[model samples]
Target: MKDTSTGASSGEAVREGPDTFKRTALLALGALGIVYGDIGTSPLYALRECFTGPHGIAPTPQNVLGVLSLIFWTLLIIVSVKYLIFVMRADNRGEGGILALMALAMQRQRGQSTPVARPVLITLGIFGAALLYGDGLITPAITVLSAVEGLSVATPVFEPFIVPITLAILTVLFVVQRHGTARIGSLFGPVMCVWFFTLAALGVKELVHNPAVLSALSPVHGVMLLVHNGWHGFLVLGGVFLVVTGCEALYADMGHFGWKPIRWAWFSVVLPSLMLNYLGQGALLLRDASAARNPFYLLAPSWMLYPLVALSAVAGVIASQALISGAFSLTRQAMQLGYSPRMEVVHTSAEEMGQIYLPGINWALMVGVFTLVVTFRSSSALASAYGIAVSTTMVITSIMAYVVARERWGVSRALAIPVAGLFLTVELSLFSANAMKLADGGWFPLLLAVVIFTLMTTWKRGRAILAAKLRASSIPLKELLGSFGDHPPLRVSGTAIFMTGNAEGTPPALLHNLKHNKVLHEQVVLLTILSEDVPHVPGAERVVVEPLEQGFVRVVATYGFMENPSIPDVLKRCREKGLQFQLMGTSFFLGRETLIPTKRPGMAVWREALFSWMSRNARSATAYFRIPPNRVVELGSQVEL
Candidate 1:
């Protein structure tokens, strides 16, 4: 019982048939368009940057061989071994991402019911997610710029127009986001298929001229380059790091397409095409050292240069689209987990649950990207800011993965230590090499991560303080129910429901309604919506209803962090539990908090002010939960912390 509209299971199990197989194949094709777009386009600029970049080397026979060997090994160890094989296995109920994996690991610890809590592990994962926002900003700027820069290689006149052309293409790309990708999504797989084939075809054409370049496949050459070149060779790693920038998508997208299809897509199509293209670039450089300035474009025949540039631009947009979608998904998960403020989330596709558009996030990213394009002015300059953010994220994933293996999987520390140690060693080396370029442009992502991390933590901590203050001032449920029975208020004829964060205590709205109106509804429902750490809560376990004294009913609605919360839908579930709903007869009461900052013990005055501002801007619960707007009544209260 798969619910195609929501992408969630409807029953105990998923149906398996020929239809399922076909569906999996289609998803795999789509994954190629979105998941592999960023990494696949690296051939356009990775090799060229290695030779002509700031730390560029001589395009000598030895240098070319060494660089090729490094590229091959990086793809094998980082993408193939670390992520596809090991990390993807640590999914949160078939969902994969650093945050999803973190939830899985935290659940494993909490299952023990121990007194000690692991806050540091949770903090590490949050910081990793924050870094991705920075990466999202840079991916579009660099990938699109690199693709358009290929035009400059054709003629000197096109060089002057490259920036303007890039800006125009990016403007259209971001503008169309509100319309959703479903209409054009079908074309992505086919277009990317052609793009990769062209990449392989160009590589094969050059490799046929000088097949000896294949010798670079051996590890010895890569090692020799580093040993002989010393400091200069070490600096080349900054450029080499570009080849694997999009590796994170492989894991992040596992929820959309299963691990099996992604693995199949990788070994069968993406890996081979990428290797051949890089090898082809190496062969081209060996034949003519001067081609190092733009070896990727040089591999193409004179007649095909313009068409190739056109195709490359499309691929760049596809890459940026995937990053933008991923950001929306991550933000939703964070809000559900109580780490962020509630915001408006619009579902863009009726058939696809994952297709969504966020106005706030979309505008913010557009501003950051356009600023980067104007500031950097060239692809190579923007490259300096790229690797550090992704590299740091990779290292953080490795450490967190080790914790999952040991604590969750019950693997022995002896085995997990060395296995994870190898990954950390390599990733830390890449991070340190990229760190050398901090003053150049690398500071941008780090600074962005710090600002976002502060905001996330502040929202989370502020909510905790607010809840504590409310609980301290509130009366227990039993005490309120007894008082209602003793001094029975005037009875109204309709039903009234009050939503509260704390289910065990009397809601502030309920108390206010009793005090001002001096009357109680014939049927009263105290409802609380609870978000679980898992992905989806089953229908049977979604609602818990209990009978209380004085005609009062307590209802708790549960949802997974990945699922959207809807009051109407939850009420339908309540109907199955023998509770009836009438649109006109039922009235929903909500409590709205106005945060007032003070020099309190909980947080600094400046942070409290920031939290108050965020609270004011967050979406209303009635709108976010999709309750009928006309049927809702809000009561306001001020709280100081």
Candidate 2:
């Protein structure tokens, strides 16, 4: 029997201690590699796009300062103030993300003295999560394309091969994902450490020559340009929005590195480096307007251009890797919470539970990424589609954050409303600027988000209806036990374990087994596994066992959304509670349902069909839960939707 009091498992790493300067500084270093990669790489294209792309303005002195000021303020306000200060405080037990925050809001709202409508809050959260998918797809495509576009600036000869080289690099990056990042992840911090220093150095070199460009730091220049340039300056916001593109990753990665590390890294290193780089680009444009065509690359001397471009490509790959890993994590969380279908989740590292590979998501993202590269071809073209998904997601997050502030933080409605209002006002304006390019490449992400939202909502609703039907037809556990007293079958020798989705009623698999076998095992165990909303649940609270009459036992095993449940492992833990288990003597029974869709009032026929297909294709419970194949038996049943 295993001891239930041992809360920490050998397979995982747990950090425990009060906050200290050393720990915070180390975590902050790790945060730079994983959390800041995407936004860090934005300098390769963000500034150039503002002065050269379709929505660009001339690189005059006033215009250059105006754009630089907007980029600086956007980063300071959106990434620093809104997310770092406000959203990070709303972590779900040390985890922060759109889904984690959503779960936190929903959990607290239910227990509030006066609650808001829960459905509206949930819908807002779901939409925000859906938009992240679009962001994930676009981040890789644009980041890589922008990095390689630097080749054209170095010389026109490398221009024709730019697309092919990018394709090859992305192909290799995605292909190596199954091997896990445990080894390479260490190198990320040091490499990014060097990269940030280079950015600051390059900017400082230019700032010394044109110290007057420092005036762009003031808000008055940004406001003057917008008012004087009219609609042209407003449209340039679509490009300025790119500077803070990867801010979401910082929040999403809070679970891996605590908020303090991420906050420290941003303020200490990332913010300073980015400000210097943007100001340098502006200074370059003031002296030579032609440099606006590729101001970031132009900041480097001819001798350093090649090395800098090489460094940027590596940074781009690291950024893409972080986003890809995030996609896998989000998908797993969605599945556990019943917002997505079950898929094969492969744990790539024995030491790290968070390192996982999903074949389905891997290939799907590749297809979308390849299509975007082929369709958009250039970084400037791809930039047209970049910000809207993130902008919309930010707006939704602020709305959800308002609820968290009022209910969870005990903030007054008067203060919370205005804070949320200010956030929305900024995000919506950015979204509106990006919306102007809808006909241009912007439609791709919006369309993709809509499709995904439909599929997720349909699957969730379908499962609810199916569970209700199953519960309605299930026999009470007391009735089943009473029937055995009246007419008991022949007693078998070994133990029988029946897996069920519901705990309060008799399992369909057990009923089918009894009907066909005409015998009962000496020991029977009915088990139900549940996935909770939190990221991790301690092992001490993992299992609940109840002994019933006639040698029957009911077991409920609970796992958190971030966990991967294993049946045999969980059953091994149950032995400490006086439940004996021998793998050779135990027989496991599982039910497999075949759905037949009809024109049901619960769902449209088309949606029912889609859900049925997804259900049929979902990974089997036996394989997913790591049950021994030799000891398993399957029973089939039909379900109508």
Candidate 3:
């Protein structure tokens, strides 16, 4: 039986079971491509960095087994247990991400025992989301660089071309984003399927010669490595942490392919492939420690090297695509949630709501990726800058998950604390390990996060302050209508829709029209658009229309944070509720604010200037709302803050 509430099926073979199974199998394949790309590509550089990186230890048998043990258990505990089993349960409706989790946790739950304030959780969530942008920038740079670096393994003659080849690949990757991934998205599954199979095949080939390396599966060897190597072994964690760098994508992309598909992909394909591959690399090290320089490439025969390089480059592009798409999604959520200024959002796929492209974000990421490649020049140098942002984000996710469990899920503090504590303990340790690289290159993402966080917070605060100022200066709708009834103005022939931020007040554009033209439309609509803290608002509950005096009507249209509002769509919904609108006869009045930063009490002078700059550059409401540009009447106004 299918559970309508959660949209999950119980284990009974019904008439539709076969179809459901096929659909799920397809989705699981797709998940292998998009969801696992980052972590899946990590095998290229993660193990190599552990033993050969700056903090790499001597490749003793004990150290090899120990590091392999750490990789094995870390995947089980962090990716399988924590993310797949526990954290995915905290999804908002069907959507999952740090922002979605923040919204879910913000919902008021009775008898809640969590001491953290809502604002604190929100700030943390925003910062976490900001950190992902840094990840987005670095993922493309590092993954592509690592993939192209494989050419060097085949022959040192290809060394000179690695950086340029990586740059060209990444440039093509970003340039194609505008065309959409709908067509190529299908190929991702099959390609990644082959990639994973290749990984397993390579590992098994090496494992047959050195099956003894399987002894590392025990936690004892991992413990012994640390016990034996002391501080150096602890430092190796910075490299080990790279294995799970893209684990957050599992939860973040849960909305695209449900947790079930992600989990299936992980267990049935991704997890086993990764384990075998890591062990194979370890076994290769045991046989010949000299292979540590490029263990992943060296695992294959000389004949397979070029083919492997080609596959790795393709896989790297797929991995970069996931992070780029995620950054776009995160930006949209931030915009809808009032934490960001508006950006022009393009719908890439008509059939899929989630497939969107943001040009501003795309170009910004492209530039950031280019800068990193040009500056760092090598994947190993770039690797030092990675892990830190993602690890910090993981720590924040754990904290938010704790609050979500205590409040949203109504789990007792007793149960919630220890589970959250376990993840936190592991994550914090990884974070500290990555922190040691701050002077080396880890500071890049942290600095980037701070800049993004500042912009988000400033935009949010600035909008709130702007609304307050407008509200204080505005006239109430009821009072305005009463005066209009007392002395009616010259009535025009068509409908005039005045968009307002405050639902209860007369819009500034409406007042401006009255003052200048001294006329009113035959019908006037005071329309207010609001964003709810959910992924989707039902169509039946999308619009609310109220008839007011003097041919005036009040309409409130609500959309979810994951949605882009459309004025024409809202009008059509209003028509369903007995309110009529004509395409050519309707006019939209929007207030165009000219912000003047002053020595105000609301914010620092620098922040005010930044907010003003953002506001000035933000996409216009006419474009953002998909309104008819020809029908828009923009009224200019100045506001000092």
Candidate 4:
């Protein structure tokens, strides 16, 4: 089956998007709106961070030239070469990113015996996903703080309000997310396009002064920065790498825009301009030291700084939009995979697969990000909170990529080991640099990630344990039929389907059917829907049937967290199997088992009350599955957990 797992599978859908080159070009440009927002807006504060950050280096010509050169080449090697050119190519039928890539590797790794060399790929994927929680908190805080702090550039009078203004901007950003990005999405590409051109213009202007600054393309300069300054220079890598912070977004967003557009945008516009801007900053600094405060802002006319800041704040909002939407998508995908508990998902668009909403995830991120903004409250503070998560995630992606290459594609020893080893070098370096920031507000994001990772792990474990316990106690229908073989089957009026937790079980309604009505329908249907991590199973895998003597056994499916299986459609699949199709009076069987308080206790009273509360308001299977209201039956049983 084709996997919607990662960047490695993006080929199918992206190629399928448009056959004509012109149409494809338009689609690619259109995609730049949301896809490239993160990297595109780095001009807002990229150069400023390098100069003003904690460091001993003077903002003199040599230092300025050196720092800007480092920024330029880093963007080239890290973003352009690593992700845009190389990683984005690994799409799974137009799906892209670390998760999709790992999903592809996992399908190929199924049932393989563990070996010393081949650790599990899912573990790597989980590690990467865990790191993203850190990325999420810092992304919003840094993006907003950087923009709001620019007000100080307009006038120092705005300095006192920076914190409040930053908080207000973030609150507004999260609050309006319910509206979805469809309306503003059109504006994304144009704004980013303009932003890129502005960066290039700045770079080109500086290049005219001292074109030799471009010679920093030599790798030795990067080595020099690390060697001479030693630990302090390593600290700058923490800030320097911020220029490439949006690289992960390129992969995460591939599912929505397709790899074709993202690849085109990066190569044609995003990469070149970023390099130019960095070089220009370096060249300008080479000419004059005082201009080092912000070669980016200095690239523009003094009159334009406020307008530039305003434009940047708007663009930063769009950048935050990409991550916000991405978190929703990842949560939905995780839920679909049975890694998370049931969450309420709302589809935001008829035509766009990328537009999705999960109220639980949205609110949680809103709270986390807002808390971060209030606590850190400055672009510099939030910067300390950002880089480590993004860096480690890149490392994890590399590990997962190695798994895919070795196992799925069957790449030989020489190729796989070297590629994985190469990534380990760069990733370890970036990770180590970012690691030094852990105590300086970085713990906030780490703490957030730990909390989220714990919740996710607990949900997966709890559900698995509960399902296993039910399955162990379940009575198979064949054995059940044999037990009651002496008696003839009873007759009932309507068809009934049990929404069961386990694939095989004596649903409480079966006992109720025997006790109350004493008869079965002309056609009895025992149905159970299975959840899988994969999204959108093809029709062939949609249903499985096993017929017993009295009725037909039907197993229909949907997804773990995102999708609700349509009862009518499943019934249609059942009929297509030549059994029968009946919807009007078909009764859905549900077990409304109540948790009874007992002296032989397991949980605290508060916990018991919480569980009971959850049960009371928890969405019913009928509504969750879109089953009709009237034709439903619930069989209550007394139970304790």
Candidate 5:
């Protein structure tokens, strides 16, 4: 078995050097803008949705307290305990996400004598990751729609212009993605600080008048709500789950800022503000049940309403930005890990490798967001579509986390099972509640997830079949090199590098080049790039050189799934290993395979056709690998899959 451990093992300490108070505070503030955006902004609609949404219940004192109790405990147990404490600990070399956790769990399983069901875990992880794309779509739509909805509460005249204004705002948000957030990113922290403070202030204003609402903090109210309301109260969880919708963002973005900053931002600022705001909303409902229609916006005084709507809109944009950026990052990871087709990826910031913009992904999300906003029209309607994707993803994360705890942390099953069981029970209930909304717009995200999942699995399986076919037909590198002594081909002066998937086999490009051109280069380098399970591969261990007969060498470059592979960078590193290259003097030969759909034992004909279409549309290897287009030669071949 391969050594699956990235340099940092589970037992190793996370280095937080240069951890001055200023730096830590800055990081925590940054965490506030990015990590807490989704959850923090939940105050806009979560409480109001419970009483006024599709499955809303009457905001009687008992029901209000019950819903508030459920919201409070849900945040405490799920966000603070489940994600910040447990799931964040299962990081893959300081990276977190469904894919990262999946990789981590799979990596540990590779090292075990008695491995668990690998396929099941991978499928679940992929589906979970797919669900995030669905979440990404709905988050921006719902958050922005809810924020803009506040304008109507301020005055009914703004109701007619809400959708158009939202469309305009979303257009600007997606448009600015290409320029990157480096400049505006600094402002995110301070702006969010204002947002959170306003949230606390608004909540306190109401709480002073009705301190009786604080009793909902007791878990008994939440339990009693379910008991008294019975099935209807259980259905209230669908709306309640919205409070924790952004919880995954906390874990997914763990690598951007360390877990400590995320935790600090949560406990020190975000949690208190959110809880107070929620309790205040409950208090307002106690005083006036009619306020349940728009409790969040109603909390503001008459003069503050417009300003609060503006602030809510800005906060919504920030939250939307975070989710959109996450989608870009996730797409890149999927491409690198072989689960997605390659698309053009542009790095937006020189200092930040994580800042990337994918035109295809950006535009696709823009389209999805537009469809969602137009179809649902109102935030209350979109609320019916929201929680299903996130709840299902949470359940998947819990399962993957359980596997990581048992296999990687070496935690005994005795302790892990009950802990995992507790999370799963809560998550499943949330999922079950959301399931009731399947007919009322929840199908949208689930449908999108299914489509994406199909494409991903098709691409992965198709690539595997294609590689197997190529390896079967290709000659071994040793055999090809050994035959050179007996019958030497005409030697050219320049160095030729052929890229191949199989390190041990002669590249199809090389074979095609020799057969057609009838000549071999003075120096032949067969290069293969491998993506490891880790988040990053250290520079020193990136390139491996193996010399073969007659000036033939086999070079393998390894990259982590999180890193992009650059041919120029690999060659620069090669210089340290006694292999030098002149950019102009080197020719990169890549195979341009035309995939043919067939019924011969692999995938179904329709899937083969889909794979072929995807392969043809994928970004060229030359562009993706950052090889100079001027120094490239493509050799064409046909492969049946």
Candidate 6:
């Protein structure tokens, strides 16, 4: 059975039915709202940047055909073949992306025994996760700057205000995110869908004007460019990286939409239109490369120009919105998987699944984007920072896919290695090419990622160090239970469930409870929530209870990284299992610790203070976990680092 709430399978089997089909189509369209928003809008700026930017260098006639050919084949190989035909099939129990694929592959390797436990697999997964953060930060800045600069294209009078105007626009966009995209998403798919078709229509008219542009489709042109132009051809790889910017979203949002709907949207809708539009732009540019300064808008007729500008602007906003939302989802996934600090997540709709907002991710991106807009005012300036992050991500994804192909799907050795090698070669070239831009504004995102990565690594290590310190000299639970003997119970009556982060390990607050009260509550439930990357689990797989005499009951609630566990709802299910519990006085105990600064080798004291400050102001567990305020108890602890 498949679940409607989260749209994930209820069993280990990857199940999809009539209803799943319907919602997946709807949400995939929703995901399409997000997925195609960035790359779909890329046609707006890609050609302009390719010609006007320093490396693009005015695009000579000899290179123009080859450039067009590279764009064509790049999209064909990366998006058409790799993503649509191949990578999407590697979904894990209807879930997708590098992490989901890794989880599935790891699980399969250890099936009926133990799962794979290789360090390289885990590290590759982390690298993919890291690249996403870098990509997310750059997407908003570049997208918004590209659109806002269209003002200058309309009238040079708007140039002076571009930065301030762009910053203000982005600030407003980030501010409005809490209201949820679900309500506004109705416009997203239709606008982007229309945007592509309209561009396609325009492209068709232009291509009909000059049929020679279609010859650029051959790879020979791209290869010839490499032979003739020397390594300068590699510079276009950075721009080509922009062409498939939203490809990751295709796989990441797969859980919301099944492979079929996405594939349908990609081929029948997105692909044809994008190709026609790119070819049309190429044709237009072939006539006058200077027109490449604005191929997308130039393709439009004079009468339709303003409307095209307006539509393009709206689509640009939507494109950024989709990537912004994707960042939120990925952050939540990261937190659930133990790599990020706990952040507040708000559910956007009652019926719709995976509609969420993370305050921390929301603000971080807003600030980062605004700063980028101020620093690098043009799309081309910000473009240097764009493709490196995404290409690195794609390369990491290809590596993860290789592991999955062999270990999980039982794919043949002959097929898997070569296919992986082909993508790796292509992606490696693109990544290296983009990497060459680090001297330009490319350091912006990389610097941001390194800061984030440091925080993530520090938090992880600090946690491990604390855990090891606590574990090394801690009293055994079995011995302690025997000694304590549930000592003089009678605190709260029925099922006072305490949510603990540590499951098999000793929970710090539990010791505090033992030391202070010296008495246990009746039917004490020590609950721990576990989140896995592969979305959703069956009800039968939900509860893992080990009942102890004298009022102790340990409960574990498992959730998908994409899903949030509602405590009240989980408790209701427990009640249905005949573990009757009262809601009003059930009392949810939560732990809140303040990290004190330490002279750790990882980060400077200022960064440590920033993390501590962030921890202090973070949303409380009562609000975050959706616990009733009056019924919640928070225990605070001081940390050395």
Question: Highest TM-score, which number?
Answer: 5
**Candidate 5 Cα RMSD (Å):** 3.3
Clashes (backbone N, CA, C under 3 Å), per candidate, total 0, 0, 0, 28, 0, 2
**Candidate 4, which segments miss by more than 4 Å at Cα?**
1-19, 115-120, 288-292, 504-519, 533-535, 558-564, 575-581, 592-620, 636-641
- TM-score of each candidate structure, all chains considered together: 0.96, 0.96, 0.97, 0.89, 0.97, 0.90
List RMSD in Å for every model shown: 2.6, 3.7, 3.2, 4.0, 3.3, 3.8
What ranges in model 3 sit over 4 Å off? 1-17, 109-116
- The whole-model lDDT of each prediction reads 0.86, 0.85, 0.88, 0.69, 0.89, 0.73
Cα lDDT tens digits for candidate 1, 1-641: 00111132221122355576666566667768878988988887888878987777899999999999999999999999999999988888777787887788788777662454468778888899899999889988988998898899888889889889989998998888888887887788778888889999999999999999999999999999999999999888888989999988988777767677677778888989999999999999999999998898889998999998999999999888888877888888889889889988888888887777778888899999999999998888888888999999999889888888988888998899999988988888789889987888999999999999999999999999999988887899899888866788998888899998998999998888887888889989999999998877888999998878888899999988888999988898888898776779999999888899999799999999999999999999989999999999998888998
**Candidate 2 local lDDT, 1-641, one digit each (tens):** 00000112221122456646666676677778888988999998999989998899999999999998898889988999999999888888777788888888888888663544787877777778888888788888888888888888889999999889988989998898888787787778778888899999999989999999999999998898899899999999999999988877877777777677778899999999999989998998999999988888899998898888889889988888888888898888888888888888998776667778888988899989988998899889999988888888888888888888988888998899888888888889898989987988888889998888888888899899888877777889899899988899888888999998888989988888888988889999999999887888889899999999999999999988888889877888889888996779999999888888998689999999999988888888888899999999999889888
lDDT of 5 by residue, 408-487 (tens): 89999999999999999999999999999999999999999999999999999999999999999899877887888799
The TM-score, computed over Cα atoms with residue i paired to residue i, of candidate 4 is 0.89
Write the candidate numbers in order of decreasing lDDT.
5, 3, 1, 2, 6, 4
lDDT of 3 by residue, 153-206 (tens): 989999999999999999999999998887788788889999999999999999
lDDT of 5 at 505: 90
Higher-lDDT candidate of 1 and 4: 1
The residue pairs in collision within model 1 are none
Model 5 CA deviation exceeding 4 Å by range: 1-19, 111-116
Q: Where is model 3 poorest over a 10-residue stretch in terms of lDDT? A: 1-10
Tens-digit per-residue lDDT, 1-641, candidate 6: 01112333221212345575565556545445656777787787777666776567456766777877888888888888988888888877677766676676667655442334555676667667667777777877777777766666667888898788778878888898888766676767767778877978989999998889888888888898878867777787787778888888878767665666667778777878888988888888888777877777778777776677677767878877877877777777666666676788887766566677777778988887877777887888888788887887788788777777787777898999999898989999988888888998777666776777666665655556555645654566666667655564445565577787667654666677767776566777778888876666777777677776557777788887667777776786677666766787577777677677778764567766866765676567677667788988777777665
Model 2 residue pairs with clashes: none
